[model samples]
Target: MRGRDEDVISGRIVEVEAYRGLEDGASHARFGRTQRNAVMFGPPGIAYVYLVYGMHHCLNVVTEVEGHPAALLVRAIEPIAGAEWMRAARIAWLASHAGNRSAVAIARGRDRLIAAPVTQLASGPGLICAAFGIDARDNGTDLCDPNSMLRLEPAPSEEPPPEIACGPRVSIGYAAEPWLSMPWRCWMKGSPALSRPGPKAAGTGGTDSARIEGTEPQ
Candidate 1:
């Protein structure tokens, strides 16, 4: 989970797409260093966030050596903790900025017996951020430090993480050809939390699910 006292929100990362600057046409670094993509060129274990369509804030995790500008775009997640807080955060954001009543109603599905599953709370990049109170303010957020409000932590389990899967990233059709066909996306295979459909990955389904693992924040 990522949060502070009284407001903890967590999710099972299900989908992600990789971006490589310079060599890759879809990367923000295709044009070289600038104000917006500077963070991606920095050290690893930090968030490289960007605003898309003037509203959505997409989150990426900086990885590889510094200056290489490689990141994994977090595409989707299944909410697992503090789900109510996630809904409230999203609802509040819409109420103040969009006044999207219906969206808020769907978010605030308080009908218990008919209440929405927490898994649906964060199914997409924008929705995931909103559900977790993550924004541009967290663009340079550290994912390596446990103390940071936004941090990557180990899965609360002793067993090994589920198998990883790869597929072509969503959107960026403009990249064309090789870039388009490159299966750089990663995820916990067969997760319903996936943002969209893709080729079936190996060793998915059953009781297996996504859990924080490897090098956790801090």
Candidate 2:
């Protein structure tokens, strides 16, 4: 991710969930295409961002072929570079919730961000958006393009990939039967940055039932 000043921030992906059109009951395209979910039925390697609970935005990577509404929800990331930028972005975002932030409030937010563990920096989809300054304007961004401000890059070849584990997707109680239990959520095994623990611990219920244009998690 890049700030307005072009200061770049990086994070290592740690968790994700998959959604597909029509067949996937939990997906927004489960019905058909619309202006809101057009990005999901993509040429691939682009973004599919949406809001949840009238607030928090979640990011996804468009997948499959053009006309195929499939995408991967990026649930968590491990902050790797530009920690200060990410922290400041997150603080500024949080401060905006109540209106313009005072000098004292900004200072207190900085203290909180500093006190927080690095592992918690981008440990959830919403947090990742807050830290990276992403919103609906970035919904169709070409994440694979090097020129894109919010680009995604593969880990260095010398670095081994983390062990991955799959389980039921989170906060989709709206889905029915088999889809409800389908283990599609994948995450780096044993990563402390995961948005949630194992399936046995996650369950099917979600805190918020509100959805955004039928694309949100819950």
Candidate 3:
């Protein structure tokens, strides 16, 4: 059984629609579902790990039922317990990608960077995985199995409010307009973990409140 704290960190999942094989507007499987997409055809609650941009690892949960070929894209995650560990992992990753002196300085300064306290650590998919220490090693892991490192537990009962909203998934330009317009993303309305003040807040006069948005809550 997952401890309450562990469940708070791992149980909830964010779903996103990926393009299907060939005819898909935005899918790596567009050419045809192959060995790479075998997980998509597998039973629900299974991991569907895939490489994105030919580099970063992205995780997904096969949804619906067996042979349904649907999954939820784990775009981001809020670090619940192992924040220090997450920061260290992100720093190491950033440092690796950093070019020279300037990049290294930016990476070092990232320690002070404040991200959403909610599960969407960084808005993008790769950053979210890095922040939460998720990788290919977790591919095909059964979330339903208590012994599995990757398991989904119930989200905390004490979240902000009861209201849930949806918006288009981020950074999927290839998905086209209507696909981009689909409000599939969901997040808490005023949760600090899910929302943050804009960068301009620290600058010259502004009094905007925190606005939360993302895939539709399940």
Candidate 4:
């Protein structure tokens, strides 16, 4: 979720990528602790927001208890509310970056060879952040806090998690070796919000949920 004060942006997370420290070459914390990655070294349930390519802010969920540099990069989300703000934000971002062609395409509903729909607004990581107004300022945010401006709530469904599929992460050729091939990414079976998609390896079934690490919801 993102908001200035009263206008909150909300969505349902649908895709994510996992990074494990000391073993995952593509992870920022693979080398060692630093000021930039300190959040990842902290407790789980926090938002590890960071900018990539100087253009987008990617939101990650810290995990593996305290002092462990592990995170799940939130890849895509299905818009739940405040879609108008998301559309305006994307257009504004494009215009600011001198992306006239794309902006015009977006304006004319001609980009991606078709009109981009509201649900597709946050289909990618950068777009997700952009759509929700998430930026570097939201780094280290405690997503578990009920009082926090940004937090994760239960999905509209009361049922268990959807069928899951695992696959290799996106665009990390620079990492080399197995890190590039590790299938740490998972998503809801065939969500349209996935940044990328591929075959699936079925894994029985289980509930997928998040926690603040304090009090469980009753």
C-alpha local distance difference test of each model: 0.76, 0.81, 0.56, 0.76
Count of backbone clashes for each model? 3, 0, 15, 0
Please give the range of 10 consecutive residues that has the lowest summed lDDT in model 3.
Answer: 206-215
TM-scores of all predicted structures: 0.81, 0.83, 0.68, 0.81
In candidate 3, stretches whose alpha carbon ends up further than 4 angstroms from where it belongs are 1-24, 99-123, 156-162, 176-178, 193-218
lDDT (Cα, tens digit) per residue for candidate 4, span 108-143: 643441346787888899988877778888888888
| Cα RMSD for candidates in order | 5.9, 7.0, 6.5, 6.3
With a 3 Å backbone cut-off (N, CA, C), the pairs that clash in candidate 2 are: none
Please give the RMSD of candidate 4 to the true structure.
6.3
Predicted model with the maximum lDDT: 2
Residue-level lDDT tens digits of model 3 in 128-214: 566656677777888787767667766677864444444555577877755565555555433344433223333553332222343
Pick out the ten consecutive residues of candidate 1 with the lowest summed lDDT. 209-218
Model 2 TM-score (2 dp) = 0.83
Clashes of 1: 3
Candidate 1 residue pairs in backbone clash: 144-218, 152-217, 155-212
Using TM-score as the yardstick, the better of models 1 and 3 is 1
Higher-lDDT candidate of 1 and 2: 2
lDDT of 1: 0.76
TM-score of 1: 0.81
